[model samples]
Target: MTNRSRPRILLIGTGDTKADELLFMQRCIGEAGGVIVMMDISVLGDPPYKAAHDKHAVAAAADKTIEAVIASGDENSSMTLMALGASRLTRRLCDDGEIDGMITIGGTMGTDLALDVALGLPLGFPKLIVSTIAFSHLIPPERIAADLMMILWAGGLYGLNGTCKAVLSQACGAIVGASRSAIRPRPQRPIVALTSLGKSCLSYMVELKPQLEARGYEVVVFHTTGMGGRAMESIAAQGGFAAVLDLSLQEVANQLMGSVVNSGADRLMNAGRHGIPQIVAPGAIDMVDFPAWLPVPAELADRPFHAHNRLLASATSGPEDRRRIARAIAAKLAEATAPIAFVLPTGGIQQWDQEGEPLHDPEGLRAFVAEMRAAIRAPVELHVINDHINERGFVEKVLAIFDRWVADAVVPAGKVAVERI
Candidate 1:
């Protein structure tokens, strides 16, 4: 696109500190079929290699002079200023169609700056960071762009060694390869956004995806992990999807119960805000997530627990929590400017909520039902089906409501379908 044989890869780093490492990365990228562009984020010292844009240019980009930033001499504030500057500069390069991909290497301060810069770019753009804390839980999901890749800066810090060079060479090759093989956006289609937990909880997504595709609509299922729900809401808010099947309401219960897997404050409200035709359900509202690494919260640790795996454990929602979550969901639905079909599965919400399961909680389900029926208002069609969420009957009920929307012209009839990703 830039009329170049090799894609241009932007090398970003704090030149004052890791100049040698940054310079090494630059050379490695060049050897790996990538044209190198550099943006030096140094605050106190010179870069080992001359950057296309240096520390002075960076400070000026943030509307602050290099002299002023240096005068402050505060590591924290200076790093923040440099990151803002880098983000601004990176955005400009993207707008100008100059950068094809980007790679940044850093420890604490460097990693922090990389996050700001990488998040500034749009999705599908190749952004990679080689960081010391690549696998750490300290990273915030909200800040990191969905497609950003990170390599553990394994031995590639301080100075060059055989080990560090090996790691750097691998990172360089990865960024170049990624740039050469850039991802193209999915073709235009009527995107049906669906949310769910894994196959352990719901199988309706698997059943409905093909059925919807057969009817000529692309089904995009968003896993209802905390970040997954937020990402779905992000895309939906931007009008990326034509319709939304918000089948998993676990994030609502997670939010109400103060679980680690809560989406955010504005989870269920985005589709309503953007007037997207959405089918809502009380899927997986029976449980709340607790991190397996830590002990469950003292208040409800005694509740019915199901260890989903090593990393995640779930506890059954109580009647009070379910009622609160139902009210929250209802309130969000009430504000919908578009048609909403809210489906309730009477038999069970998830696999674990079935007969004789560890997560069985009829009292909590009853509370949710009582509150939902009372609180939800018009423009939202409520359907009560006497079957489990994974059952064929429940799947048909959802499809029927969506089909009705199509017939009523709420969802356009001549929609195109996309192959499942």
Candidate 2:
């Protein structure tokens, strides 16, 4: 940790055009007990005041000069060079422990660069982007960093206004506050990355979390929703987990079905890429989620639907969809370099898929089970547990596999804490 008292915030923007807004945010950060480190990315014109790192410095960081950037001859190409430079410099700052957090402001162009910069930093570092299209669908899921924060830059396109000031002030305060309070991940025990939905749907986390922790593993359960799964995959890509219990496949189903509630294309492959031993399950793979507020799509209109709430709803997939997802899951697991185990619970996958629930489809469940049986083969061991996913027996099956792996030295053994008598 640095000896400095106040958090240092790196503020990046096109100073030539957003001088007033940048200066306003600088003052706001100051009042919130933060020091602003300014980096100007303007190519054509300069801001009224000098920035700590100007366009020439940014261009040089990319191994190019300001003249070379302007010589690129197009806005997109010029900005691409600047984006490269800004991301490299921001990462250098973070690696050197010079900046505590980062906040960038802009419309589309600045937001584009901000995404690259944010993605370059490690997880748990505070990175905020105040943009005109903060949550717009125009931004792809893969471009988003796991811990990035964003606020809509309302009414601040051309110049500052009362509404814009309100938004900017709140954003500045948030960045400063986050920088001060952010806790970097420092697990005491080895981390086990677990993925599941709510307790109402996938209940294994309820039992598995405490049991795993008692056995001296830190269980970090990701919700397997679109963003949650993406965050887990992000951390896993960095080799963050000792092992992965990917017990939910809803995001994969969402991706195959072309739903907006889907994680990126690389959903189920990250942990395996790092050779992390993982236990995989098809929990909730029979259903695809869409926003509840919207009308059901025509193709799935005839399928059994369940409204979890006003915000989210799910429709059961047909037998064919289940078969297709099974093959897809198997293909991803096939690429794993480490030991992989696939557990299939024959009775039911989710709470709502049991006998009398709204989403009850015994035939659909059977289809998934049969296809999974045929698809999972070779290096990936398959365990067919004939119990509902929420059943005690199913939990035992998972722990049994985990324990065997630990004993065989495939997984690191959990350490129970001992107290001095």
Candidate 3:
């Protein structure tokens, strides 16, 4: 096989039982003009061929010796050690620009090892797994990364055959294809991260994205879906964003109130802790989300409700819940050392929050505002705008804050231009 200047894909799996199949996949990748970096993670046996990262090095990376890893002699302990070791080593390889993508094929233990290492990589760094558990319903969100991909192992089990080879070849082609195409040459613009509930709530994001792009800022929008918020925060904590437009905070409410679509605990704190300037709003704070398949919790069914679709539903929060949400928002903002603007859209926060809508609870809104006023102090400037969040009036107010921050050099001015879309 000849090497091309294409992506070097990392193949990680057990060498004890699956070495033949792993080596077969390696040949397929090589024949496809891709480079392969093979890792042997088996505790009990050796690979058929030389491995780039072997069991000994894998164990050592985890602060354990291969002998100790083997001494444990259980599948759980062995897989755990190998996964920990592989994660550390793989991340370092990525940092040093050694591997462009990673893939693994295995059954149970192998799947766990592959996932742990691959998930440790950053977003857009193509990672794939051909596993028997790919179709399992018990996947925990924490085990999966934002962009990881998986396919059923199908006919591939103990050895390589026509059926398994076809599957393995497809996986090879996928990683190679991803390596060639997934990562873009990042634009030389400042990055701004924003959160919103799509069109389900009329959001400024539709207008703001292009405006920010026109100003030479690359805008990244994260839906306030539970995982969406967590993904945004994960990247933000890694210093990925120059500034944050955290306009939709319903995830905070969802989290506090036990909704299924809430970002995890560390949602709103990252950009602040990273010293990035932010414009914060309690957008869509009037509701909590639940999957459409599930009945509204008996406790929550009494609130005003909107069936957004068969997939999403929103339930209005009462005065007490609104007050609790406001306090939660305030507590999170209080942790920020960076400059922040807390803007409240006084007229309404969401589409269903306007006049004649199901969730238009002015009394609850007032209670929320009162709690916010009682909780937030200076250094976090507060502003109240009289228009609904979806209105141009609210958009302009947010842009005005952006412009002011640019003028004060709190954020990069970029090539300033804002055009209506």
Highest TM-score: give the candidate number: 2
Q: Which stretches of candidate 1 lie over 4 Å from their true place?
A: 2-5, 56-82, 155-164, 262-266, 269-275, 291-298, 330-341, 377-384, 407-421
TM-score for each predicted model, relative to the true structure: 0.84, 0.94, 0.85
- Candidate rank order under lDDT: 2, 1, 3
The number of the candidate with the highest lDDT is: 2
Segments of candidate 3 deviating more than 4 angstroms: 1-6, 68-81, 105-116, 131-143, 152-169, 416-421
Candidates in order have lDDT scores of 0.84, 0.91, 0.84
Q: Write model 1 residue lDDT over 1-421, tens digit each, in one string.
A: 5424598999998777887788888888998889999998888888767899899889998989888887766888898888999999998998799989999999878899999988788767789999988856577555566577888888765777788777788899999998888874574568888998998788898889988888887778889988888778767665677789999989878877877687677788878889898999999987889888888778777788898889998888788878888888888888888889899887889998876999887888788888888877787888988888999999999999888889988987635545598
lDDT, residue 21, model 1: 84
lDDT of 3 by residue, 54-106 (tens): 98989999999988987776879878988999999999888888888889888
Candidate 2: residue 56 lDDT (0-100): 92
Segments of candidate 2 deviating more than 4 angstroms: 2-4, 71-73
Please state the error at residue 370 of candidate 2 in Å. Answer: 2.4
List clashing residue pairs in candidate 2. none
Q: Rank the candidates by TM-score, best first.
A: 2, 3, 1
The digit string of per-residue lDDT tens for model 2 on 153-231 reads 9997799899999999999999999999888777778999999988889999989999899888989899987998988
Instruction: Tell me which of candidates 1 and 2 scores higher on lDDT.
Output: 2
For candidate 2, the lDDT comes to 0.91
Tell me each candidate's RMSD, in Å, in order: 3.9, 1.9, 4.0
